[model samples]
Structures are given as structure tokens and as C-alpha cells.
Target: MDFPCIDRLEMRQRDLMAGPEPTYEKVVTGYELFHDSTPFVCDHGGVLPQMDVAYESWGRLNADRSNAILIHTGLSGSSHARSHAKNSRPGWWEKFIGPGLAIDTDRFFVVCTNVIGGCYGSTGPWSVNPATGQRYATTFPLLTVNDMVRAQFRLLDHLGIHKLHASVGASMGGMQSLCAAALHPERVGRLVTISACARSHPYSIALRFAQRQALMADPNFRRGFYYDGVQPHVGMKLARAVATVTYRSGPEWELRFGRRRRAPDQPPALCPDFLIETYLDHQSERFCLQYDANSLLYVSKAMDMFDISQSVTRRLAAQREHAAADLGHELATTAAACANVSVCMNIEDQPASTTGHSQAETEDEIAQDLIAGVRNAKQPTLVLGVQSDILFPVKQQREIAEILRRAGNERVTYYELDAMYGHDTFLIDVVNVGAAIKGHLENTT
Candidate 1:
């Protein structure tokens, strides 16, 4: 829809454009490896000679540093998970965190960080490469879920947290939490993943692909090298509006904005005449300039490329190829690969079934591989699913629980919530989501 009445004067004054670097220094407490000499290697062979990680922490670490909980953020979340001394403003997950909240800052030390491929106080495509003295932009290496989780563990190591009390996350954060458990089972004592998937399903991938297309189609995007030029405000706005459709359910939308017209008697125009359209426009406008367009593209692609079963299959193949490889040693190598070093892995770009295997066979093999991957994650786990969620459907949550259980995790606690907010139930329905998390954290058995 054309918004011809947006008041270009007001838009010009607001400068509805994001700069190439992050301006969120106040939101982050400190960096993890700002002065370290060791380089961080990516899954796709990208190297950061000296990386910096922006992170925020709440509460205190015990003397032995055992009462720590690592929280992962969704696709666009920042390091500020809650308000603290440095930043008094409420954070994205403020409702779910704080003293006596679901995360219970009074009893646990909660740490959250912006993923590397992010724009919020973290090194992303917007960051200037020290090697070339230029913004990575479109030249940034491809990222995967494993790469993001590895960065988080590096921060954990910096905090001297050898093991976590629980790894917690929702949405994309859920994928990271699950990866942390499967990839580094010995370091994660417990797991809590909400509204997550074991793999990037085709439906979610297609939705994200469409969002990227909308963003890249803008002339201002300039193929992700829009630095020193006009930012892709139009593209980012349209992409966010498209993503808003997948974040909630049809029933919720119908209930909230059912045939509601901005002006019931006014003639329809190309502009937003309906309440839902206006709502989407407002959301898009608010988000369009707050994030870097390039970072969004990179992070979305990483989410699309995430597949937990691939780790399992790769290990099994290694053991088969080398009879001298021991199970304990292989697990250690996998943990190290997910820590700070690269596994030298590439994105799985081939079709799902190409070895003359039927679709059913491929599906079963992936399931078995996922089960094998999580076999070492025997700690107590909690998985929550929203029935109305179309993005990461309830079936995906069920699959995580089933795989964990089949992998011999007897302490898996699965909950199927009937919230109307769809995939965002964990973020909105705090009462139900918090209760489950609180109970899981408090449960000793």
C-alpha cells in the first residue's frame, strides 16, 4: 500500500535510518573478547582475529560459579534482556526476567548476549573489519545456529561459568538453547526451550525467504552495501510487516481487528483503511530503522540453515570412517567445535532426499539422528509449545520432547499450551509461560 501522506518533513527530521555501527553501548555491560588474541573461527570458515561480544548480566555468581543460567535471544533481540544499573529502561524480556520472576534474578545469575550477526552492541555485518578497515556488509560469512551458540559459550567461559544451571530461550533462542545442550551436553546442566524447532522446516524457511526478498528488492538496499547511502527503510518496513503475519495466529488477529475500518464511512484508498493494516504499518515503521538491514538478512539466513541432526550424522560418519575414534573423545571434539573453534562444516544445501531414499526414509533417518544427537543431554528439560503457533508449530515442540525422551532423557517435561497468541505465546502469555519455567527451575526431581 502506498503511504503518500507520511509527511516527508517529519520523516526527514526523524532520520528514519540506522547507521552502519551500533549505538547501543549503554545497553550492554561489557565485551567478552575485546582484547583477546585468539581468533574465532566460524562454521563456514570465516575468521575474526579478535572478536567482541556485547553482553549483560543480572544477579551474582556463586563462589563456585555454579548458579548461572544462560539466556538466548530471538532473531532481533539485543543483549539487554532486562533493565539493570547500566540501562534502567525495560528490556525485551523484562516481564519474564527480574528478581522473583521466571528467571529469578535473586537466585540465579542470568546472562544474555546479542548474537554475533546482530546490530545491537555486537559485532555484525555492520561492524568494521579490523583487517580491511571496512564494514563487512554483504561480505560477511554465512552463519549457522551452531555458530551463534558457540559465541554464547565463549561469553560463558569469559564469565568463568564452566557449567550452566539451565539454558533458557524462546523462538530462535530456543534453537540456540537446544544446540547448546546437544552440542555441549556436559556444559549445560539443564534445558528449557520454548516455541522452538529441532530443524528449519520448509514452511518457516519459505516465510523468511520472502521477507529477505522484500528487503533486498528495495533500491536503497543496494545489494546489502547500503552503507554511506540511504538505508533500506522501505524494504525493512515491508519485510517486518510480512514477518508480523507469521508471529501471531489468525484467531488472534480476527479477535483483535475483525473488519475494523479506520473510517467506516470513508472511501477505500491505497493507504491503510483497515485497523489491521494500520497496526502493521505502525509496527513496521517502529522497527524499520531500529535494526540494520544487512544484519537482519544474515541472521535470518542462519536461522534457515540450522539443522541439529546434521551434527549427529557428521559424528556418526566420523566414527564409522575411523575405527580408533572413541565415543568419549568424539563428544569432546564436538563440544570444542561448538565452543570457540570451527568444525569446518558447510551449510547443508542439497535436497532433503537425493540418495535414492524415499521421503519417509529420509524423515525417519533425520529423526533418529536427532535422537542420537540429544542422547547425552540427560539433564532435566522443559519444552513448551503453543497450539495456535503457525510459524514454529506445536508439532515441532512435540518433536523436541519426543526426541529427548527417546534419547533416554526421563526428566523431560513437555507442555502444550492453547494460547491464542500463536508463536509469540511465550513472549505475551507470561503467566502461563512463567509458571512453567518457574516450576521447572524449582523442581529438584
Candidate 2:
């Protein structure tokens, strides 16, 4: 299908800044790290000579430096989680994070950093490769949730933050929070994960594969080396269109635009005909304007490849029994199904193994580690799930809470929000989302 040309696309930033609501007065200072002497190592054994990570912070670091919160972004989010003194464009989580809001910047120091493999200021496919003098493009090594967490840890160390009072994230960000809590149990005191899972389900992986295929289908993509020429805007638009559908619930679409034609009196044309089609088109266009095509490819793949169980298993081998009886059995069955697909489809480049272990063994170990982490986690954790969410179903959230409870962690709590917004409920349903987070923080304190 023909899509809008990248050159003709008008870039219009969303008007999220204008509001009467109170915002943080502290200057949102921007910071960059990992660009000089430190080289970042990827989970796939690849190394970047130097990497750049862009981040923003608000509020004041107390004398004891204990009132700090780290906010991780989703697949398309940046470091700008909320409005600040400088740029006022409201961030992705502006409603849930402000001076007197859910995060309460007035009393806590909040930091949000763009994930490494993102289109935002952080280093990714668009960044120039120090070795080749050109964009890394497809040459950028594959990344995982753990790799992103490790990068965030460097930022925390740079800021002299030894421990976080709380770590919060939704969607892809939730995966990062899970990784942080599991990998560095002592660094994070409280954890909140919304609409996230321990690992990508096969259905989610299939959806991601379709998006990647859409991008690669464009001849102008040139295998992600389209820096000097026309971009694959059509592919990117199509990919976003697919993702937008998964982000919302079917009930939402039916209630918002039920078979309503864009033009009531006119006949259907080659372009969008229904109101839903128009909505998807608008979302796709907006995404294409703001995000990098290659970055989307990388970030989505990272989400699909994320398996917190693997990271936990690789770290604490002694806690295998906790996982073996519960999560391990389920994970092994899923891995077997995935293996069957891989063999039948002849797709050999599986990104499951973080270490040198075989895929089957690694999957088994991950399940054990996940259970162990939940059992061993001393910090209070809150897992929030949206009832209508299909991408990361409520079942996933329940599984997280159940595993934690099974591991004998009494501090774990799970809440399911009743919202038609589906996976996007955490962003759109601020009242309930904010209340849950604030209540958890208060209880922990």
C-alpha cells in the first residue's frame, strides 16, 4: 500500500505543555554519560567504543540522597517524563508525575533516562558509529532489557545514587524496572511494573515480527542504511498502524468509532474510509514524524527478546528450587513450543540466550531465577495490570504477583485497573493509576 512520503510529512509536536495544573518548578537539567572512557558491553558480546545516554532530572537530592526515584520509559518514550522549568512540552507520564502528583516531585527526586536503543537523544541506530564514521544503522548490536538496565545503573552511579527509593515504569519501562529490581536487588527499595510481562508471549513475538517485516519490505530501507537517501516512511507507518491496534482494547475502538464512515455521504475511496481508519492513520503519521524507523525496529525487538527470568537465573543459581516447581514448568512448555516454531520456520537467529548456555537450558534456568528473585526481593513491589489490556494481559500481572507470593515475599501487591484503554490505561487513566502508585509509595514509607 502506498503511504505518505517522508519528505512531505509535516512535523507537528503534540501540544501537551499548555495546562493550568501545577508542575515542578525545578529546572529539568539534562545529562549525558558513557561518551568518553567507558565502553558499554551488550548482552550479545558486542561493545560500543563509546555510548551516549541522554537523561533529565527534577527535584533536589536530599542530604542523605535516599529520596530518589528512577522512571524508565516505554518503547517510544523519552527522558522527559514530566514538565519542568526548561521545556514545557508535557512528557509521556506528565499526568502521573509532577510536584503534587503521583510521583510527588516536591518531596522526591525523579530521574528518567531515554533507553539506549531509542530514537531520543540516547545512542542508537541513528547515532554515528565511531568506527565507521556513519550511522550504526543495522550494525548496532541487538540489545535486551538487562542491557538497558545496566546503562541506567551507570547513570545512577554517576549521580551518586546508591539506592532508589522507588523504581516505576509501564510497558517496556516495566520490563526495565523488573530487570533493575532483579539484577541489583539492593539498589531499588520499591518497585512498580504496569502492563509488563516476565517474557514476550508467542503472540506478541509474532506481532513484532510482522512490524519488522513491514519495515524490511521497503526497498528504500536498504537494510536500515537509508540515512543518506529516502526513508522507508511507508513501512514505518504501517508498523505503527499495527502497533496502535495492539495498544488499545477492542471495546475502546467499538465505543469510540463503531463503523462510522469518515464522510457520511461519500463513497469509500482508496484512502481511509472509516473513522477508525482515520484514527489509525493519524497515529501512524504522528509516530512517523517523531520517531526513527530503525529505532522502532530495535526497541520492539528488545521488548520481544526481554525475559527477566533469564537475568534472574543467570545471577542466582542457588535459588533454582523456588522456580522449578512453579514458573519453570510453564516456561519449559512455552520454550518447547517456541523451539518447534524456530525449527519449522528455519529462523535460527534466536536472541533468548544471554549467556553461553543452550536455549532450552537457559529457558529452564530463567524460570527458576524469576521465582527466586520474587521470593528473595526484600523491597515492596506493586504490579498493576489493566483488565482490558491485550498486549500484556492481566494474566501476566497476576503471574508476577503469584510468583512473588509463592516465593514467600509478603510485600508484593497486585491491582487490576478497570479501563477500556487497554495497554494504554496506565497513561490515560491517571486518576486510578496515580492513586495506586501514590498509595503504594505511602504504604512503603
Candidate 3:
């Protein structure tokens, strides 16, 4: 009895064993775009006929295509994670990247890509829609952390990276990193998420809502259609000022700016009298025009709407639906692969097999859902939380570690930092944060 499926499986094993290992050349060290004409379906109902992802990379991919690390950016950061030959300017994470740094570009092929809805080179509110030949502006589709990761996946496929050695991020970047590994456990080997939560809390959502309100209040905003006119500078400034307040601790601010007047000699005015006020003014002034207002609204909302439990439900349901249509084929394939026991063993690190169980089998418990979301992420995980960060409290980080542990991820490492820098501790307190990251990256076990 000659079984065709078993014969094909044996031939696949022979091809794998006989061939020389494939190798990929290192990516160019500069800004690049991965363009896909295929319609990108959004988590929401919106769709894009064509899209582009702007990215930058450093170091070399090994011959076996391992040792690749993908770094996600904070809410406003771009793809420039580190300085390269093409771009000499220092990046947002300049201190943490490069040779002998926390990320160690010398050992890992590090890459960072601006989120699709960002104001950077990637397609967003600023990009012109091919269908209408006009800018998408506020008309762009609603974005989610999952949508952002899915878009990044397109770029990864283009670069021929089948899997990532690690995915790292802080703040909103942390949210993206967590979502990436949860949604595609097979694609990411290790995970590091700092100052992030499994879901957006009420306080954080309120803060982001206030930022949106400020931006929308400007007459020039014109309901997010201010692209061709004088920008809503006042609104944007106020919004940034509000966001800046949440980025650091009040205790740190007291030490940095205190009650000192901007100018003691000058009589008090209605505006920017205190040093702290002036500091906020400087921060907002520099930011108001740099980023697109609509992008700020979109990305922040995405962060607000993110809930890992909901995401897991959606993913599992989709997988169940897909499996229902091809149960016979799946059984045959599983049988054929079982015939080649060694071949199956060689790929043991692959994603866990999805049972043909109905989606209803998964309970609606939120805690259970959170656990389920990351259940298959058997990688070494690092979760960092800053005690002084009011926006994303340390408890959120604790929850992440607890959930991962409950999910049976034994390699999870949790850190509670007491840095005075608050939510921005990851950016300023590099000595502590760097050491934590360096240790995690080097841990091969």
C-alpha cells in the first residue's frame, strides 16, 4: 500500500536533509520601504489597496537567518532605532543600541519599523490614498496594535525573516511587542516589554482622550482635515503639553523645575510664569509641528482600545473557523507528518497545534483569556515596570508577569524599577534598564 501523502512527506524530509543551508544577505543599512499592492485588511472594516512600511536595520543576518531582533518604537518614535551608514543622526534609542550597548548591534541584526499609522514615511493620515488621489487624513481606517504588528509582518516576510530572535519595546512599543508575540507566537522567539499593560486602563485612556480633545478644539484642526492649511498649532501644543505631563513623575518635576519663576524681575503674566510652565512650553513647542495631529489621535486610540483578552478571542475564533473548512486535509497532513517522526521532532519549536475544538470551548473569563493569549509563547520573557510611572503603573507589569507565569511560561523575568523618571525611566535611567536588557538578550537558556 503506497500512500501518496506519506511519500510526499518523506520526499520533503529528503530535500531538507540533502540541501545546503540557505543564506540571506544583510539588509542595507538605511531607510527603506516595503511596499505591498495587496489590499491590507484592517482589524476594523477598513481596507487599503496598497501600503508601504518604512524601516531601518543594522548588523548582519546569520547564514541560517537567525539572530534577528525587532525593536518596536514608542508612540512618536520613527524607524531610526540607531545610527547607520546612511543616516548619521542619532536615533531615539541611540544610547541603548549599537556595539556593546544594551541591544548590541554587533551580535544581533536589529531592526525597527515605524508603525503603519505613524506620521513617519509609512502610510498614514499623511499618505495620499490611491483611490481618491487625496490624503487619507482622518479618513484613514481605525488602527489597532494587532493591525500594526500585522503590517510589520508584511515587512518581515519581504525581508525573508521567517522568525525573530527577539522582540523588544518600551511604552507603546511594549504594547506592540506584547501583541506581536501573543498574536504570532511562532514568529517571535523571545519577548521584552517594558512599562506596558495587557489592556489600557481607565486613567491612561482618559489622558489620551484629553490629548485628542485639546487637538480637536483648535479651529484650524478642521475635523482632522488641516493638511492643506495652517496647522492646528495651538491645539497640538496643548495636547503635547498634556502628554508631557504624563511622561515623567511630579517628584522629578519638583526637583527639576520646582516653584522657581521663569523670570523673577518680570511681573507675573497669565502665561508661562513658572519654570515648569516654560519647560512644558518648550517641550510642546518643539513637538506641535513635528508629528501629524491625526496620527497622534489614531495611534493613541489604538493604544487605548488594546485588550489582550479580546485579541486572543478574535485570533482563536479565526483559527477555529479556518480549521473547520479543512479538517480532513489537516488530519491527513498530521498523519503524514507523524509517519516521519524525526522530521516532526526537528520542528518541535513550531507553533502548538490548534485542536479542532470549537471557539465555545474557550471560557469567557478575562483572566483566562489573558493567559490563553500568551499561552504558546514559551520564549524567555522580560517584563519591566517603573514604580514612578503613573500612566502605566508597576502593577500592570506585575500582572504581565503573573499572567505569563500562569500561562506556564517558566522563563519569565519581572523587574520593578524605582527610578524617579516615571514612565520615561526606560529612556533616562539607562544604566539600570540597559543592564536588565543586556542580561536578557545574552541568556541563551
Candidate 4:
């Protein structure tokens, strides 16, 4: 008797050679945060003297400020989550973020920020180091999902957004959204995680390791300091090509490409004979043009190291019942104060609040609140999984939903999309994704 699971695994192997289409466009933004005095500390014990975070906003902040939604981008995404006056090209999530859409920009003030270690306007390996007056390159500190969330918190603080109606993300962005809720649960009233997990699976780790090796193998890599000269484009392209395979499912490749040749007239002697080969090449070429090799390495490492289970376990171990209650009360009070304030980005140059507490002190309080909130978080959460996704399998999504339900969150919901696009379903199946999100948002609101 042929087992269904065995058949599915075989199909996955067959389509493993195929690659999905690359989709990322440059986002134009006029907002940036410059944090020079206060340093950002990384989990791996690395510190940056100063940092800059680039971001973009959509729609207006409601009077009560209860309609704010924070969107976390995937590994290759920039702060540009949707179209604006300066950017005419569609954003990565343009379909679900506009007016009356899934995210409903007309009713919600949406914010998307480039992660700190991103190659975009954010301070990454491409950014100049104040001490050396050169790009950080290989010297850039290792980052974690929490580190990325911390940087975003700074941006939110600068914008005077103390609470989010919902935190939504897909892929790496999904990872960030989970991190944000886990790290600062009180600040996030709802959570939507799609095609992501609490930690990278071993299979994903191996794939990422292969991609990193390809980049380092390039002679032009020069230990990631190639900005002065030739870049390791070849290796970067190879890495992208490898990654594209995991982003799609085997059944998708079989159905879409079907072992077809690029052209019936093409000679077999020429390279890239299969249609799938050309598709991967196109994806690789597009990615190498827009993304930095080192940024890929840093972000991949961050994803691999993310383990929310460990974080939750540690916080629970350190908590005192009464202290947790006290922290929760303090968080509610401070969050109200933060929500009521209307601070502008220009306030970066101004001194700390005149309320007697230093900026560091205020941040520390917020951090503590976030940790305590995570321990007792009971926010409504929606976990979406793509049925064919290999990178972040449906099992992982189920685990996320299960964890939240077991943690006493009564309103947790789980939805699995039966799409053929695999991990790319979040981007490709906009209608289904939007409908589910809209339904959840409406029910919660």
C-alpha cells in the first residue's frame, strides 16, 4: 500500500529543482531615525555606537490612535510595504495594504520599517561605521530577531505609537511579528503570523548554510568587504537561485514547468536546457541586482538563531507572580501615556523627556513591560500556513497556533491555505490571505 505521506515527499523532491519568481521593489521614503547617543546592543554581545532606521507610513493616525497596524517585511523586503506618492511601482504587499484591502489602510495607520541589519536605508553592513568612517562589512555585529524588534521599538517610540492594533508579517516578517508580540505583548493587541515559525528548521538551516558557502567561495567576496571593488555577484546569484527552490513546492514546479525546455528549437548542448533552470536564473539575476550579499548572510543567521520557545521559557523561569502583575499594571499606565503623546521624527535632536526619567530609563521600563506581557500574553492571534510551503512547513504554523492556545490565549485561530504556490502563497494568493485577515480583524475589532 502506497502511503500518501510518502507520495507527497516524493513529489517534493521532484520539484526541489524549481525556483519561484523574485518579487521585491525599491521603496521610496522620506522618514529616518538617527540614534547616536544611545547604542543598540545585540544578543551576540555586539554593540553599535549609533544606528539609523528607515521607515514609511500609510494612512493617518486615528484620533484615539487605536487603528495602528505594524507590518514586518520578509527577508528581502524594504520599508516600502505599499505604494505612495513617491513610489508608483507596487509594493510587495500592495494588494493587501491599500484602502478597503485586507490591512485596510483607509481605517488603519500602517507602518513598515526596514530592519536594522537590512541593506536598505537601515544601518547594516552597507552603512558607514562612525569609528572607522567606512562600511561595517564583515565587522557588522551578529543580529537576532529580538534585536530587529528592538530597533523597530525605537522607531515606534520616535513616532509616539505606543500600541499596535495588530502586528502582521509573512516569512521573515512573520518572524518579526512573532518576536514583536512575544517581546512586547501588551503593545500588540492582535497578532497575524503567516508562513513563519518560532525557529528555523534544520532543513532551512542547511539550505542557508549552502547559500552562505556559495557567497564566501567567491574570490571577489574579499571577506565581505567588496564594496571598494568587485562584488561577489556570481555567488550571490547562486545563493538566490538556491533559495528560490525552497520558496516553492514540488507540486508547483511539476505543474508549472513540467520538465519543459525553454525553447523547442534550443540545442541540448547549451546550458539551462530546462524551463525551470531559466526561471531560477531570472530570479537570481533580479535578486543580485537589488540585495547585498552580506545583508543576506546577516538576516539568514538571525532567522536561524531565533528560538521563541527558549525566550518564553527563560522569561517564565525568571518571573514572580506578584512582580508580573505589577509590571503589567505599569505597562498599561505607561502605554497610555505613550499613546497620548504626539512626537515627530524631528524630535530626535531634542533632549530626553523632561519628566525626570532619562531616555534609557524610559526604554528600560518599556522593555520590562514587554517581557512581563509576553509571560502573560492573552491577545487574539491568527496563524496562517501555506499547505505546500517547504521552507516554513504547515507543521510549524500549527505548532505556533498550538503554543498560543496552550498559553491561555482563548481567541487564537489557525488557517491553512490549500494553495499550490507553496511558501509564495502569501504573496500570490492575495484574495484568500486578505479574506482571512479581514475576517479576523473584523471579528476582533
Best by TM-score: 1
Better of 1 and 4 by TM-score: 1
RMSD of each: 5.9, 10.1, 17.7, 12.8
TM-score of each: 0.86, 0.83, 0.83, 0.80
Error of 4 at 265 (Å): 3.1
In model 2, which range of ten residues has the least summed lDDT?
16-25
- Screening candidate 4 with a backbone cut-off below 3 angstroms (N, C-alpha, C), the clashing residue pairs are none
All models: lDDT? Answer: 0.78, 0.74, 0.79, 0.74
Clashing pairs in 3: none
Model 3 regions more than 4 Å off: 1-30, 310-364
TM-score of 2: 0.83
Ordered list by lDDT, greatest first: 3, 1, 2, 4
Give the residue spans of candidate 4 off by over 4 A: 1-36, 311-375
Model 3, 37-120: lDDT tens digits are 765655553455578888999888888778899999888888988887888888888899989999998899999998988867
Clashes of each: 0, 0, 0, 0
In candidate 2, stretches whose alpha carbon ends up further than 4 angstroms from where it belongs are 1-36, 310-369, 373-375
Writing each residue's lDDT as its tens digit, candidate 4 over 1-445 gives 3354345434533443243311122324454445634655455534565778888889999887888899998887888778788666678888988889998888889999888888778888877776657777777777777788888888888778899999899999998888788778889988999999866778888999999999889777888887766667678878999999999988999998998997778556345668898799788866774787888988987787666754333432243233334334332332321222221111122222121223455644533433443455578889999989989999888877766666667888899999999898998898899999888776744
Runs off by more than 4 Å, candidate 1: 1-36, 310-361
Residue 365's lDDT in candidate 2: 68
